[model samples]
Target: VFTLRLIHIFAIHKQLGPKIIIVERMMKDVFFFLFFLSVWLVAYGVTTQALLHPHDGRLEWIFRRVLYRPYLQIFGQIPLDEIDEARVNCSLHPLLLDSSASCPNLYANW
Candidate 1:
């Protein structure tokens, strides 16, 4: 859907011809169906794995010992590098000082 939307935008800008735009729009439905099918397969696989593995405690141990600390640390963190800050905040209006309040950094901005 995003790819088709982007192609439509390019078509609007006259970078892509009408024939390609039509083909892309037609393929969007096929893409949507495939996406949902893939998601369903992933969910089915995970459920099957859980049912097959019973309660061995390994997953719980990994979550508690390996993932919990990093998850908490990542919850509310900011990058300290100047280049990173600039790259992130370039889309933001100059008056907005908070990094969290920055505008979306899109291809058009870059």
Candidate 2:
């Protein structure tokens, strides 16, 4: 955070009488800004359910969620028939799948 780092440096300067802190506040600000920017970018990028493909069967994204217990968690009701139909028509093959391929069979009707 440029704002936070600037304040930190400004405060540290007063405490130490204008000496460079152990870490450069500029670098700290850059790293903080980049970290939050990365998360913000990812959060913006991953909101679409169509982009995130979660396998109810093979890859088991639900279990992965339980294991990871991180943010970005989402839940929704999925019909059993839909999952079955998707398993029946998954011609794309499991090889081409990642976390961003749309929930399996979520759009089988399309």
Give candidate 2 misplaced runs (Cα > 4 Å): 1-23, 49-110
User: How many residue pairs clash in each candidate at the backbone level?
Assistant: 0, 2
Model 1: worst 10 consecutive residues (lDDT sum): 101-110
RMSD of 2: 11.7
TM-score of each: 0.32, 0.28
Among the numbered candidates, top TM-score falls to 1
Q: Which segments of model 1 are wrong by more than 4 Å?
A: 1-18, 56-110
